[model samples]
Target chain A: MLSCTGYAARSASDPLAPFSFERRDTGPDDVRIEILYCGVCHSDIHQARNEWGNTLYPCVPGHEIVGRVSEVGTNVSRFRQGDVVGVGCMVDSCRECKSCRDGYEQYCEQGFVGTYNGEDRQGRGITLGGYSKSVVVDQAFVLKVPDGLDLAAVAPLLCAGITTYSPLRHWKVGPGQRVGIVGLGGLGHMGVKFARAFGAEVVLFTTSRGKIEDGLRLGAHEVVLSTDKEAMARETGRFDFILDAVSAQHDINSYLALLKRDGTLVQVGAPEDPLPVSVFSLLMKRRNFAGSLIGGIPETQEMLDFCGAHGITADVEMIAMDEIETAYARMLRSDVKYRFVIDMNTLAASA
Target chain B: MLSCTGYAARSASDPLAPFSFERRDTGPDDVRIEILYCGVCHSDIHQARNEWGNTLYPCVPGHEIVGRVSEVGTNVSRFRQGDVVGVGCMVDSCRECKSCRDGYEQYCEQGFVGTYNGEDRQGRGITLGGYSKSVVVDQAFVLKVPDGLDLAAVAPLLCAGITTYSPLRHWKVGPGQRVGIVGLGGLGHMGVKFARAFGAEVVLFTTSRGKIEDGLRLGAHEVVLSTDKEAMARETGRFDFILDAVSAQHDINSYLALLKRDGTLVQVGAPEDPLPVSVFSLLMKRRNFAGSLIGGIPETQEMLDFCGAHGITADVEMIAMDEIETAYARMLRSDVKYRFVIDMNTLAASA
Candidate 1:
């Protein structure tokens, strides 16, 4: 086993502090990477506090991990030493399932392994996340991080970026299509960039009026303050696709009212409260409400290449390893500009 | 204006009492139908009690209307005296709107006019429904009921029939498809029949095991008791489409979990309470929850023809016009076999 250190939450109420943990040594099919930076996802806070009721203790929660490869197992062909690689929400799956064969390993019939806190195949110990110094994962799940993009900004691409991008790609978002992206934080920001890159007329839906300029800067053709009824009324029954990234409970039906016939609204954010959807909203126009999780390795790599081609990456603020606690607090209040990326150089010094 | 006698709710709590309402003289585009039978719809109860908050006073709640044309306007070409016709939920719509032009007048962009308690284009007064002896409507919204199907049992074909049929047709249900009907009442019965008619393998999922025989009798290839975990597990991720027709809020996520990847569950019933959905379920399978309203006039005519050809009609119990209140109560308790059809002969004798 390889020894590593990461900021860990010992209890639900405990602040993250330096803690040592053990990761398995790289096996024949594994790659060991020094995690360069990790994107802070909203789920990190949710899991750390056991908000969704499935949290395991002593959690080191991070999934949007980007780093430089330090070592590769003898049979690992995907990466070599010093290769820039990324790991998203998943690490492994029972690869024989139909979903895994169909490039939807995230929906593996036997369940895909999560990057952190989820049980491993042997059901031995809880899986640790990417908040630490290094990680060893099977070669199948590792993605090549493209050269020249800001490494810190590219971290969230593993989670938030792919989470939004997967739905857009699955729905075939394209030219002349009107796309509505709900919310304006980490997931929503990527949604805007991806929708724009997909040649869509992107309209950003946000509750915060202050996000209008940022939304526009993120490549939205328009920003709708969702609270404005008149503005909403004007755009009723217009969108072809709506990527709803708002995790908090809100009026999902109101967004449904904005969709054209056969248009779909895909939700990636898991709300703590259940959304009350009016069946009439979907019935009247043949509208659809769907949800998507972070994508698999193949699609995640596709998202990265798409981003690399379009020069798309998250607008991020870099913080040191110890600042995750404060970053999490600010994240709760939606205070972060977009995403928070951990600078792992700070972690090495402290270690 | 002509005076028409019918049953109507003078107040929200009132029973169906004798009332007089006005009918516009046949315009060039008008067709006046003498209603022979009106199917009792669950929505009638909701509107009569103002449960959905859009009820108007002196409401005559019947949209599943099967009637005979008593008169036609000079320029009306679609119908003439003695033609059998029907009216579903919608009565009027702006013909120029995209939805109206696309033959989806039920989803008219300008908000399609309801058959009952909705304002007409001229804004003279709210339009009444076919619970009355006769209704005057624009020929565009009137559908010709096919011959050979029993008129009494075909009334529900105008509403419940088309509501289920539209989604089945839109979702491309066809031969060799595995379709699940989630309830066995008005809409689910129709869904099972239609899916079977479309040459699909129909499966009925019900909370009641007693419905198993009746389900197979209604064209279902098999019946699965939804409460049985082992039975549910045996069919996991298998259905290509699920038609959810239960109006009461329940575990929708459970039904969603039954769908195969990229499958859809269309809700035809309106539950007052919001259904609680887990994002993980939908994300895992790429499943979709959608809503579908009644079909357009063209499609309703097609459905009636389809039902007629298949010898399919609502399993209805005939009742006198005076028994509407008791019938509604029975309908709410699931005491009726499938539908209640008012005998207009009883209406004429009583009046």
Candidate 2:
């Protein structure tokens, strides 16, 4: 067993605290990496608090992982010691499923194992995530972090980045298309960058006037305050595709009306409640309301490479390992500029 | 001006009554038809009773029309006098829009004019539908009812048949695919026929155990009572395409669960209230919840041709023109085997 240190919630009601655990020794196909940074996601807060009602504690919550390889098993040929790598929302999936064969391991029929609070397939206890100082992962689930990108800023790309990127790519958003990014949070910010990088005419839909300048700085061509009926009405039937990143309870019909005929609004964020959708809203325009999870491994790697090529990375605030609880509080208030990335070296220093 | 005798609702609270109205004289681009049969659609009842809150009375409620061409203007080259023709839901659309140019007139950006209770583009008056003795329509909106098919049964094909066929065709449902038809009403019956015709393995989903034998008769390879939890459980992640023809309020999430990864559940029926959808239902499998209106003019024509080639028409119960009110009552109870075709000769005899 390899000793590891991480921040973990001892119970649903407890705040995250320093915890020590053991990771499996590197298997024949495994690559062991010393953690560098892990991005704070809204879901991490949800799981840490057991808001989704299925938390396993002491829960070490993180999935957006970025690290430097320190050791590699004998059969790991694709990576070497000292290589930068990442692991997103999933740690492992049933490899024999058709989805796994097709490289969409995130949607494995038997359910992919989550990075944290998930049953471990390797006979270990519940899997811990990237909040730790070190992790042992199969090479197949580890992604190559592209060169020349800010490592901390690249952390969110593993979760928020891939969650938004998969839908844009799956829908084939590209040049000459009108794309809309709903919300301006961590996910929406990346969506704007990726859509802009794809050469699309990007429109940012937000309720906050403060995000207008940041939206443009992040690559949106236009920002429409979604609360303004006149402005929203002007954008009616304008978007070819919309990426809905708002997890808060919102009337999705208002957004559905913005889509052009045959257009789609893909929800990447899962809210606690179901959305009430007027069938007529969809029927009249032949529009689609779809939802997409974080991407498959192949596409996640593709997104990272695309980000590297386009000079795109999430705008992030650096926080020390001990500040995650405070960061999560600020995140709930939409106080972060975009994302919070934990500096795992703080865990090392504290250890 | 030409006088026409038809059955119409004088007010939302009133039942069908004999009414006299004027239709325009046949113009150069017009074809005048002596109505033979008209199918009773659920929307017809809604419109007649102001259920959708946009009725222009006296509402002559019918769009699924089959008739004989009694006269053709000089510019009407597609049809000669005595030719059989059909007219569906739409009357006219902006010919210059991209949707119209692309042959999807149903989704015209400027909105297509409805056959009844719609603003007339020619400034004649509110357009009236086909529960009448005669109709004069532009040659562009008139479809050719094929030979060697039951004319009465073919009436519903104009609306219900085209509505179902459009989605099946749009989603590219074809041979070796598994298709599910939700509900066992007018539209679902047509979906079963079209899916079976396309050589898909057809499954009919119904709440009524009584419809099991009828579902098999309507070309479904198997019928599953959607209310049976075990039966529905057996069908989880089973369908490639699900044509949702249920207009009543039902939990759509259960059916959404039945779709394979990347599969679509296309809603063709518009219920009174919005349907509640869990984003996780779509995100888990990358499934789609989509809506489709009646097909475009070109596709409707293609459907008619396909129906002709495949010997397809709606399963209809014949009724006198005066029996429309009674039929609408029965339809509300899901009592009709599929559709009711009003025999227009009853109108002529009463006159």
lDDT (10s digit) by residue, model 2, range B223-275: 99988999999999988999999888889999999999999999998888999
lDDT of 2: 0.88
Model 2's CAPRI class?
A: high
CA shift of B260, model 2, Å: 1.3
TM-score of each: 0.88, 0.95
All candidates' chain B TM-scores are 0.93, 0.94
RMSD of each: 4.8, 4.0
Q: Please, what are the lDDT tens digits per residue for candidate 1 over residues B236-262?
A: 899899999988887887888889888
- Point to the candidate with the largest lDDT: 2
Instruction: Give the clashing pairs for model 2.
Output: none
